[model samples]
Target: MVCSEFAGCNEAMQGVIRYNPFSNVGFIEAMDQAMSLTPEDKERRMMLTYEHITKSSMTQWIDGFLTDLKHSFNPGQTSYYLGINFSKKAKHKKVNRLMQVRQGFKKLNIENCSTSLLRSNKCAIIIEIESLPNVKFSRHSVPTADVIETIHGLLIDKRNTIIIVGKQTRETLLNWFGRTHSFNGNELWFAAESGYLYKAGIKENWQKLTELENVSWIPQARKIMEAYVNNIDGAFIEERQSCISFNYKNADQEHGTMFIHDLYNLLDKSLKGTNTEIIYGNGFLEAKASTVRKEKLIELLLSKLTTSSKLDYLFYLGNDSSDEPVYELLKSERAKNMFFESHSNKFICSLEKKPSEADFYLEDVDSVRSILEKFYNNTKKKKKIRSFADLTKITNSIAIESQRLKKGTVNASSIANLNQ
Candidate 1:
């Protein structure tokens, strides 16, 4: 049963194959793979998907969003704020502290220590896909094959590499990479969309969607959105089975706001008492059926991961609000106990000056590449992989370094800001 990309149909049934229509070759390949799966295998996948959808409800999605929204803003201010929430005086204090640390880092002989530190640890890296320089919006509208090859190098390494991204974006990357043909549909595991959907791609399961009754309002909603787009010069409609978006990024703020207000009023009155959800971001207005969230997707991934392997270190890096749920979860005692206690759990930001739950900051995408390259080099040189116990020694040495710096025993070497 090959399923449409979105529609409440994904939520209503279990054990359906999923496909992204944007990639013609990939879509056809997925269909071909589905035909070869055994009936028992299909049943097992279906049961699992059913169990998942039943456990993760629409209400959970709404609650998760509200909770994340609350935590996203600065402590005092209520409106949307993305940068570090420092006051004028606090900013000065922070800058001074950063300067002190920068000096301390420079004084520390880290060049000799870098390889040894990373070589000892078994690392699991959860890097956001869009954070890389090659994938930046301005550089490549879609990821090139070269970018995917770089990512594949990281993935095929000894370390556990997780690329966190939205489902739509992941689909595009997979198409470009020519790796979409998977028998079990476990090719892209860490997407913001439900992992179960990816797993369900083993079989063509569109029949499962047709079994469920259609939402009568979906077509009408599309029509209403099209009408709005037709009237507004810069406003354009993006239609999906699960959502409709009116994008006005090129429009002036005044005109965009007015159109949003008019559309919101119309939708509000027309779709009142229905299950439709309205959400606004940057220069886009969206209405969709609330089914799942990024946090829930990550949570499932974590659970599934435990059955496979144990890691000594975990690093999660992301740049947007969608990444907040996983960040917030890791901040909790439960997630800490489950994943962080025995491991060196570090959350990093790809860029500095961004407000995040990250413990450390990398300057930008270049730093990311540098760090990964360093790690790869270290790993490639090693004759044997180090154990967790051996890894602790490296961490202990870093601790000693910290103490020495605090006691002012180390001389400040020349300040060479290598940024990595």
Candidate 2:
């Protein structure tokens, strides 16, 4: 049985058996059904979802987003061709500017942008990695080995790469990045707490709170929050450096919504005139300083990178509401002026049909990997290899050549060798 909570319901609706664990009887029944299912029944159900999963090809996803973006700025030019005919003979010119953003740790697909830059001279990638969630309730921190490897490969390309993390302090992120393998001070940048803390060489920090939170507010607020949660079975509060998060995951769906509304109302009345800002997410309420935001960080990064020349192309991929501002900013006149006139792509990670500011939707983590891998494998070569066999042979040859060069074993006669 697949016990689905919030967002997993969409998966259950497709083919999987879904159960709400909050109800003992419902949970047991679903488990029984799963255990008793025949092989034929399971096969039939799995086959039903095959078409759903393969309908959106990764290439189609990228192409569709780029096509839509091309018409976005000048809709009046209805006859514009949306096809992107990547030229193999195209000269490897320095792209004046290339900027891309992705939510960190949610998925290991940041390599997609780096792979796109294999044909360019200089580019930038800004990623935001949220703080690791507390390891309570059987939740273990996942390994980021693949993520680290991808980042290292990008660093090898000698491009401007910045990783923004929600560390408690700037020094923490600095130390962490320092320990990462393949890290070079000249090639990579680190930003902590949404660009509020970052290396000075890249850009100056510009995040400023309108009015700082009162020092006494958290203590008083915690008392009221504790008193309120004491009566509720599943509600709990976690204190942070600059904010407090109220989680309602253990509550049933209906009661959880009611509890959230009541708590928001109660907190609003109790914390009136305080400087804390109450923010609502899927299953949690975060009361934080108003200055804690990602938009300013993104703006500062873009401003700093774009001064020398306008952007050649920009792409931003994110899966949260915080990402909306970044999307809106890229579509603004200021960004337009900084970009060589063309369309910019914004992709949202989504589960079901939903309204979003992004131009396209990527279904889930697997889709993220699929599209990213496609971009990573893409390269420009002068020779046209028609078959998979030919492509494989040439790719192997290039790999061997690269290995020889790295090992300082290249023969003099091979100096004049060409791909064709």
Candidate 3:
């Protein structure tokens, strides 16, 4: 390659000829030198260039670009993009800055909890079931088949498994599970509508924890939201049994923001003094009964579970702000006095480790499933002999076979005779 002695030009390489592009005479001289090379020299240069090109191909270049991009977004990693090296001190500072940006989304250490669960005789797991905006099949979304099967195993084994969802109705949650796999839902519980509605089991009818009389403003609120969202492209209203949400996830950013503020004000003024409250986050605005709280439902469920027996371990997994209060409740001093043994362990995990009440954070929904599957596998009971006599008989048969082998009753000659 004949090129100017600029940034990427390696002039020392055999296949490369560098010229001062600023000097026309030098550039012409370098071009003439390149053309006058003998056949052998041309072949040698071509071979060297071919080798260099093969070593630094487009794939490698793309990979380097992507790595650099990743480092740019998630700073603090030592980057070696385009042959530029970052100093250790600089990397450390970047790392600290990244930590600050993360705002306490620390990596979850599930090993200890897994070990503790295995040793514990009884455990309960609570999972939030709301998908984050713009995320597909999020941890808070419906459970996958593997996750379903794992939870099934836990439930069949009599582990208390409760699902808490904000927007999904009990019917939708059931359908999500039913599509994946069928299992006994006797021990499983569903807390839907952010705990305003709940069902004890699959066969059980959904019961309201709070009366609908308080949420009489829902119909009017839904009508107002529906009318407001009609003008905004890609914006819609999602109506639940006791909650209505304005979803602007697909709307233009500026329009969504403007609509959210206007919608909040509209609802705030229209629903004044009604038993309803407006809450907005990320990509949506929600209006629900003011009395609906997920943490209270959890406390009620825990009280119910503890009535039968004290829990040995409790695990709570959530992905959004709605679950944050539960995390706080679980970690509170008053929670210590409720249902669990004094030495019982509790774990609060969030899908992302941002600033929150959760002590540990998982990367995504897949991580949540992976850890649960690990726990299920770790706690699975080993197969045992049906009876002691069956064990003894198997042992004696093995011993007798060994004695026969020692006596040469099962020799190669005997086998050959039998074949003959």
User: What C-alpha RMSD separates each model from the true structure?
Assistant: 21.5, 20.9, 23.7
How does each model score on lDDT? 0.51, 0.50, 0.66
For candidate 1, list the clashing residue pairs, or say none.
1-204, 1-205, 1-206, 2-204, 2-205, 2-206, 15-46
Worst 10 contiguous positions by lDDT, candidate 2: 93-102
| lDDT at residue 351 of model 1 (Cα atoms) | 44
Question: How many residue pairs of model 2 clash at the backbone?
Answer: 0
Q: Judge candidate 1 at residue 188 and give its lDDT.
A: 32
Rank candidates, lDDT, best first: 3, 1, 2
| Residue clash pairs of candidate 3 | 105-353, 139-365
Question: Model 2, range 130-210, lDDT digits (tens) per residue?
Answer: 322222341111214454444444454333343443423455554444443443444455655333455533334423323
TM-score of each: 0.49, 0.49, 0.58
TM-score, candidate number 2: 0.49
Error of 3 at 24 (Å): 65
Top TM-score: which candidate number?
A: 3
Count of clashes in candidate 3: 2
Which stretches of candidate 1 lie above 4 Å from their native place? 1-122, 127-140, 169-173, 178-196, 199-221, 231-236, 246-273, 276-286, 348-420
lDDT of 3 by residue, 1-420 (tens): 687554243422447777644456768999999989999998998897676656565776577557755555443432122333222222321111122233344687778867777667678877765432224424233445666667666654445455545566777767665323334444567787778887766666777787776667888898777765767787777788788888776688897785565567568879999978676545678898878877788888788778877887888877656777888788888888777788888888877645566877777666776777767765564112224545777677666666777887765554444333
